[model samples]
Target: MATLRIGIIMHGVTGRMGMNQHLIRSIVEIRKQGGVTLANGDRLLPDPILVGRNAERIAALARQYGIERWSVDLDKALANPDDTVFFDAATTQARPALLKRAVQAGKHIYCEKPVATNLAEALDLYRAARAAGVKHGVVQDKLWLPGLRKLQLLNDAGFFGQVLSVRGEFGYWVFEGDLQPTQRPSWNYRSEDGGGIILDMLCHWRYVLDNVFGKVRSVSCLGATHIPQRWDEQGKPYRATADDAAYATFELENGVIVQLNSSWCVRVRRDDLVTFQVDGTHGSAVAGLTDCWTQSRVNTPKPVWNPDVRQTHDFFDDWVKVPDTTVYDNAFKVQWELFLRHVAGEGEFRWNLLEGAKGVQLVELGLQSWKERRWLDVPELTGREGA
Candidate 1:
């Protein structure tokens, strides 16, 4: 079997998403599994060079993971022909510039979501990548989640005869970093860092909608800063400049409606940090980060309309648990394998940069809708030209 020693120039490997999702879960796990086997019985191994501005952090990560290569210089790393891929999980503001540089260096591109903070920048990045004729992708990991996969299966099987609506509850209370340090970065609450709930989760929601319910045609949103301030990692006070919560309603091309509530300040009382409930004419299903269950109308007995009588039957007891037919890995790891396969030309990669641009468009429209307090129409992604 042939071995593909793929050199990966991974930027922002020190950050939360970079470390946990890209480095540890995806790359390291793949290495531990004796590399990914190609369809033709070949094997592909990732030779990652960790790139970052911080020397100490880079060295620490390299030692921690037994990674041989580490570099503080991105430009020098990009010049290496061995590094055929450029992966970024940098701050939203840094993504466009880094990706542009990667394209000019003739590297395949992969990056974290909200590809850019705005629609124009996102579109330009897509356009640039298209012109470069490079294989590019944005991490759309939620689609590969086990619970969501079950939902997709049910949807595909037509269990939901006519889709009616989708309701999503996403979030958990992040620490204020005052007495205790926050779980997320302080920049997430700062606008200057390209941090906002709408910009972040709307990207996930866009793909979830397109893949499961239908294509989103328009949206109306209300964004808010529920918490006015937070403390930084150094225990310094910082003013919250970004919206922490976003309430958005989407109208799909198929006429199905979706309501999503995303927030960082909200308290969690559900099964997981993220939960999606989908209701249709024939059945209803609710999926969380770890579990998915469905209720069919056949099991739901008809009830008489009575104002004086007490309800007898238990509605919640009727839901059946979705069977786990296949072994599922962590969300990011699943996507990593898929991307690796696609890059090797074993299969087609559908989640390209244009789909990422559409996500940015949804967030842009969301912000506009919030500002004007009106519904906004989302434009179609009719290839590179329309985007």
Candidate 2:
């Protein structure tokens, strides 16, 4: 079989999401699987060059993953003619400028979400990529999640007939680094470094709601910095200026109401770290990251609430687990494969930079809602074709 080698410059891959999800789990896994086969009998092989600030770290990553190329100089990597694709999973503050440079070099761009810290910058990146006439995409990996995919399947089968509302609970307590080390990077709790739960997670919820349920029409949000002090990577204490938690409500254009609670301070007591409960007229399904439990209207149990007596009913027993019908790959890897195929002119990719901008817009509105203490209307982002 003929092999078409596609060169990719992976930047900021030394970071947590970048290293684990994009590089090791996705690209390395694809390489291990003998590359992606196309319909025309040609296989697409990825030749990724790890790019980062630290030479030693990048070299170690390359050696660990069997990657042939590693570079500390991003400009030199971008200047190479063979590297047609540029992927970034860097901090939100550095994204716009990095993407701009990539688009100028005429490279196809794919990146982690919250494409920019603000809607204006996010829109600028989309416009630039469009003007450069390059293929572009952003990570909305939740759309490919198994549980959410099951929800989509159920929705398609009319299991959730006339959906009325959606409730999403996402978050887990992160150590404050005093007694135990912090699980997340300290920059995540600093506003100067583009850290905040609203900016970080609202982007995710926006796409999940828009694609899975309906387009978000408006939003009302309240934010809090639950842990005011946390230790950094160097074991130094720092004041947390960014919000660690957010309670947000969204109104969908299709009349479905959505509520999401995202935090790094709250403990997880649900089926998974994240769960979405979709309530409909005929049935209801509660989906975690990897599992879904559904309860049909017929299976719904009726009970009267009485504070005086001890409750005997087991509420969890009423729902039936959704069976796994097919093998599922890593969500990030699935999106990466589709992006590679799209870059190769195989099919359409709807989640472009414009969609990324929409996510940022939601983040902006959510913050505005928090500040104003009222609901904010989410206006449509116009001027881009197929936006």
Which candidate leads in TM-score? 2
lDDT of 1: 0.90
**Candidate 1 ranges with C-alpha deviation above 4 Å:** 301-314, 383-387
**TM-score: model 1 vs. ground truth:** 0.96
Global Cα lDDT for candidate 2: 0.94
218-247 in candidate 2: lDDT tens per residue? 999999998899998889999999999999
Q: Write the per-residue lDDT of candidate 1 for residues 3-116, one digit (tens) a residue.
A: 888888999989999999899999999988877899889888988999999999999999999899999999999999988999999899989999999999999999999899
Q: Which 10 consecutive residues of model 2 have the lowest summed lDDT? A: 378-387
Query: Candidate 1: which pairs clash?
Result: none
Q: Against the true structure, what is each candidate's TM-score?
A: 0.96, 0.98
